[model samples]
Target: MVPTTITLHNTGNPLSPAANERGWLTNPANPRQASFHIVVDEREAIECIPLSENAWHAGDGSGSKSGNRTSIGVEICESGNYAKTLDNAVKLVAGMLKDRGWGVDRLRRHWDWSKKICPRLMYDDGKWTGWIDFKNRVNAELKGADNVKLDSEKVNVIVNGKKIKDGKLENGVTYVPLRAVGDALGATIGFDNKTKTATLDMKV
Candidate 1:
């Protein structure tokens, strides 16, 4: 499926954890045939269906224009630690959007597809306040991603057997603050604003 949007849903079963939700989908006797791409909770996110293929989510039927064909489905599990679940869901969804180069505007609720308050928690008793907050949180995550903070998540750097600071590993590439690393290596790093040029000087 060439997904154009993301469709959000809440499991609503506070008693059933993410693992349970995943198990339900996998169970042979569960009878219900609907599927979601990912199910996320506080501690884990599980992928039930591949994003390259469509799932029977959205309840909009198998038509070409239906969300089932045009969008990816993510079900947020609301078991224990509701806030944490929401937080994890935001990260998962934001990562997805970033992977697709999509903005927050591509997010849609189950209500948008089939007029069902499917992500029932976010419906906020029909006021949609919770939904707005949820999208805002996802938007914030996307903004942080744009700022490239994802680089800070891994690795330490060392040069000439000396440890370096501000070392980052993002998308399999290591990045360091040029000025800081240059100074550590007995060099000066300079930048010219007018020309947008960066210069490095080494004293041997």
Candidate 2:
């Protein structure tokens, strides 16, 4: 799976970071057949499963065809300082979104996929607003829209060993049309005006 969405989860166990890491590594197929892409704590974010493969984390069931197969699952550890743990999760999620060119709208709570109240800290304490706030923070970290300026400057763009002249720099950030970049890189690019979204198709 290319991970079109990000799913948030909670470990629900008050285990040390190392203990949580060990659990995932040692039990690849637990009773629930549960697994996740990454486990995050106040100190670090540990990747247990490969992002290229889907993990059975969404709890939507084998035949449901849900987030377990389509989204990247990140379990936040609740055994430490909750604030620090959440900050780590935010950074990890922001990095994932930046790498994939995805927007905050792609974020999904585990609850969104299934009936499970996951990332429990954000759901149980009347703190659902925290999830929204997290998305907003991730969007701001992307720096694509909120940090750009109207003024344009000339910038050289090279794609597939060829120079492209349409690139521009605004507020010290380089900008290029998705279609132009995709074409130069031999990929199909599409835009959805209604959603203001760009889709890129690359041959793997």
Mind giving the per-residue lDDT tens digits that candidate 1 earns over 1-204? Answer: 999999999987889888899899879998997988999999999898888999998998999999999999999987897867887898999999999899989999999999999789877457664676677668878887335563356568777788766466777788665655675788755555346565667877
TM-score of model 1 (CA atoms): 0.70
Runs of candidate 2 exceeding 4 Å displacement: 28-30, 63-65, 124-127, 144-204
Task: Please give the range of 10 consecutive residues that has the lowest summed lDDT in model 1.
Answer: 145-154
The lDDT for every candidate, in the order shown, is 0.82, 0.75
The number of the candidate with the highest TM-score is: 1
For each candidate in turn, the TM-score is: 0.70, 0.64
Candidate 2 local Cα displacement, residue 97, angstroms: 0.2
